[model samples]
Target: MKLARLAGPTPVRDKILAIFPGALGDFICFLPTLDKLTRDGEIDLFTRTEYGDLLPASVRMRSLECYEISRLFVSGVEEEEKLKRFFAPYSRVYSWMGSGQPDFVRNLTLLSNGKLKVFPFRPSVSRIHITDYFLSCLGAGSSDEITPHIPIRADALAWSGRLWQQSDLERKSVLVFSPGSGAREKNWPPDFYATVAEWWEKKSAGKNLAVLGPVEEERDKISGRGDRVLALRGLELGRVAAVISRCDLYLGNDSGVTHLAAAIGAKTVALFGPTDSVQWAPRGKRVTVITRNVECSPCLSPVMKSCLHHKCLTALSPDYVIGRLEELLG
Candidate 1:
């Protein structure tokens, strides 16, 4: 295919294996690229254990199991040994890595044990968009080329349907508030989130909080509402994505779940604090990034390791988010 023009002279499909050992949202973000490979090859995935279910339906059916590789993407002979074991049968392996295990993917496509190895990359290429980086690896032209998306799993749809039946919610214009992400450092104030949620609840009527990720402790602090929020901490990764897909709008910190919302086609509102909102903001999808753009803003991802006083997030008020939501919802 024209997409495989970057393959040089290698075989079309050498038992392809893709790796993306990272956060759930990050993995979900890669699903679009995975979708493009739909029915093209017998793909094996090596991602974080938690995100095993987050992959798209078409991609997931291909093959292989997702095992936890490592928390951080480290590379070396030892890591090469792991790839050596994984790709023993597969001749062509590609790890979709911008920050994940690129080395493992690179080492497998070697001729003289890394001496005659070739990769789909060149110098002066760094800090590209996440989707572009991966699609480039798989020989796709540009990430902006607008690829096809796989449908949600049938099981997930049935599960989500049952959830609606179980709840007293009217299933009206739903607004799902993902009130957690990016840790306390990059997270906008919880009260700020509460204020936005309150406004959305009033406006959207059937609006409620999804409380995505491990937000059980935080969900308890959401006073004045009993059934308005659903703690999805116990829900599996696929379940979380399905629930978010059911929403009309999603709002959250600039974190993985925010990206998941964008991936699933929800009109996402992501709050940016210490992180570089420019680079970390949700991709091509419909997303509105709310940041103050202060003098010291984007300090977390730009310059410093972490900011001491997180005024950037504090500056993001409820009124501000609600204003953005009003525009987005309209």
Candidate 2:
């Protein structure tokens, strides 16, 4: 009698490792390149563990908190053998961290046996769209479409459904707002968002939900609005994506959640003030970017911080944003 054969696990074709320390928006910009790389080989990413849910299933995520990993930044390798052993598994390693540090590049190159490639954390002087810049770093052509996609897990969707039911938003057209960004200067005023929310509810009879991260949690941007508006605070990135995915439309400043909203394919309206929307706007066919073309607009972080009067954003009245929303939804 012939014995039945058991199939073993499939071997990874080409093992690649990437060390990325970018925030959510940067990671979103890097997603297309990650997708491209996945076609060539299996990838292991060293990044914040919270981003694990956002990555493709083929990619394995490793925590960047390893003490040994931090040793790569030191000038002299005190644990050369251990570091070399750790890096021996991958055929090549790409790092978005420590590109500006000569010691890190030199040490990592030596330890990985010259298998390491380093790219800048972000574009230095170039005003190119970040997605295109990442592709160019890989010596690849521009993406025909720059839309970055994140697949919502079944569990995440279930969580969203539960949240929607709990929030009394089931079967209602919802508009989600992310009113804050990493920089206060980039924000288009909480009162401005409130004005927009009032208009959104009155015009469309839709529920407005404001998602706030650590930065905006203390500010109470969208409270005292009764049942027409709800505020979601202290949610993980995955849950935030899920909630945004269930929304009819999304509006936000240049925050990571805004990028996430676009990546999740929500119809998004991105507000731009100090930042240049041309280079950093969320990429999607359904996304609209609103900016004030003031002569002193698109200023750098230094200028933005020093600016006494933020006319660039304050000038963008609630009426203008509502008009844009009408055009977008129509």
lDDT of 1 by residue, 172-269 (tens): 77777767774656666666666666676677575575655555545656533555655555677577678878878787887787887776777778
Q: How much is 29 displaced in model 2, in angstroms? A: 0.5
Off by over 4 Å in 2: 1-12, 216-218
In model 2, how large is the Cα lDDT of residue 154? 85
Residue 245's lDDT in candidate 1 = 80
Minimum summed lDDT over a 10-residue window in model 2 is located at: 216-225
Query: Which 10-residue window in model 1 sums to the lowest lDDT?
Result: 115-124
Can you tell me which runs of candidate 1 are displaced by over 4 Å? Answer: 1-13, 36-40, 56-86, 96-127, 143-150, 215-217, 301-306
- Report clash pairs, candidate 2: none
lDDT tens digits, residues 1-330, model 2? 999999999876888988888888998999998888888888998998999889888899889898767898888993578887888888888888998898889888887789888999888865788888888877888753867998788898999999889888887789999887888889888888888888888886889998886664324756656665788888878889999999999999998889999998988889998898878899987788999889997888899999999999999999899898888788
Best by lDDT: 2
Q: Quick one: RMSD of model 2? A: 2.9
